[model samples]
Target: MRRREVLGSLSGAGALFGLPAASAQGKAPPLPDAALAERDPERYWARVRDEQFLLPGWRAFLNTGSLGVAPR
Candidate 1:
């Protein structure tokens, strides 16, 4: 495909997947670390996880296979 067509296809796919545009490009915003640490760690993390924008029509994932790695 041409460049424009490829870009359009990728953009559409991102929207269809329910991924926030920025996060879909691997630019996930940092969560508030201090606040999270002060609260119950497990409960705070569960709230953060619940806020993630996952693929459309999906409920939950049992593993990390679909998640991206942090930049080094």
Candidate 2:
């Protein structure tokens, strides 16, 4: 993605920072593509990380860590 497009997409991220916990939970809103891509709290990281960097399942995780994490 181009830098401008990326910057525009992330333009509202700071809004969350200003919101109180209740307000943040009050409404569910649509997500931009970037946010959608990372909604996977399931540790959907690459199947391989830095070590082998090419192994089939080197970076996969069961993602049982974050209780509040979202689904892919």
Best prediction by lDDT: 1
For model 2, residues 25-59, the per-residue Cα lDDT tens digits are 65543333444347763333332132223334434
Alpha-carbon deviation at 10 in model 1, angstroms? 16
The regions of model 1 sitting more than 4 angstroms off are 1-26, 53-58, 65-72
Global fold similarity of model 2 (TM-score)? 0.22
Q: Look at candidate 2 and tell me the lDDT of residue 8.
A: 73
Q: How many residue pairs clash in each candidate?
A: 0, 0
Candidate whose TM-score is highest: 1
TM-score of each prediction: 0.32, 0.22
TM match of model 1 to true structure = 0.32
Candidate 2 wrong stretches, greater than 4 Å: 21-72
Q: lDDT at 61 for candidate 1?
A: 53
Global local distance difference test of model 2: 0.46
lDDT of 1 by residue, 2-29 (tens): 9999999999997877767656577554
